[model samples]
Target: MPTGPKHQRFVFVEHNEEGQACGYEEDCRCMIGEDHDADASDESLNVNDAADIWLSKGMDEDYMFGFSEAQLRRAAGLS
Candidate 1:
C-alpha cells in the first residue's frame, strides 16, 4: 500500500523491456519477469471493492475510469 499524499503516490505499472505494458500483468497480478501460477489468484477485488479503494484515495463520487466498473473488474479477473 502507498502512504503518501493523495496525489503524490506513485502508481507502478509493469512494462516490458520495450517500455510498453506487458499485457499480462492484469491477468495474473504478477510483476514483470515473475512466473504466474495457474491457481495462485489472490487478487479478486471486484468493482465495489475498487470503488471503496478509490474512495479512500479521495476520488469524487462522480468520478469514473476509462472503463466502467464492471469492465474494470472483469479486467481484474473478478467478473
Candidate 2:
C-alpha cells in the first residue's frame, strides 16, 4: 500500500466569454475544492467535467516510471 499524503490529480482551464478556449493546465491541484489563488482566472474547473464545460483537455500519458526502493538507496550511496 502507498503511505503518504493523499493527492488528487486534476486539470484547470482559462477561457474567454465567447465560449472559446484560451489556455488549460494538466495536473491541477484545485480538483477537490482547493484554493484557486495559484491560478486566479475568470474560470476554473476539474478534469472530469469535460462534458459539462464548453471545452476541456486531458493530461498526457506519463511514460516515465518512478524509481524503485533499491534504486533510490543506491543513488543516495547508502547501498
Candidate 3:
C-alpha cells in the first residue's frame, strides 16, 4: 500500500486592483507562509486531479500527473 511520493498542495487568492481579495475572506484565506491546516475540513482540489497542486494568479494549463520523475519530465517536454 505504498503511495510513493507525496504531492504538495497550495491555494491562490484572487486579488482586486488594490490587492485585496474579491470575496470569501474566511473560506479563502492565504496559504503562503503558513502551515496547511490538517484539521480543516474544507480543502481545495487540484485541477484535473494533478498530483502537485499549484495555485496561480493567472490561468495555467501546464498542470499534469505522473508516477515518476522521468514521466513528469517527458510530460512537460523537458526530456
Task: Give me the candidate number with maximum lDDT.
Answer: 1
| Candidate 3 local lDDT, 1-79, one digit each (tens) | 3332334445444433332323332332334324456665574432222323322312234443223344333333455
Better by TM-score, candidate 3 or 2: 3
Q: Regarding TM-score, does 1 or 2 come out ahead?
A: 1
Cα deviation of 10, candidate 3, in Å: 30
**Candidate 1 residues 1-79, lDDT tens each?**
3232222222334333332332322322223223333464765444455555655556544543323555444444555
Better of 1 and 3 by lDDT: 1
Locate the minimum summed-lDDT window of 10 residues in model 1. 1-10
Ranking by TM-score: 1, 3, 2
Query: Candidate 3, residue 34: CA error in Å?
Result: 39
C-alpha RMSD between model 1 and the true structure: 13.5
Q: Which segments of model 1 are wrong by more than 4 Å?
A: 1-40, 60-79
lDDT of 2 by residue, 1-79 (tens): 4333344433324333342445444443334344445666666342223222211222222311122333333433445
* Structure candidate 3, residue pairs in collision: none
Candidate 1's TM-score reads 0.26
lDDT scores for all predictions? 0.41, 0.35, 0.36
Clashing pairs for model 2 are none
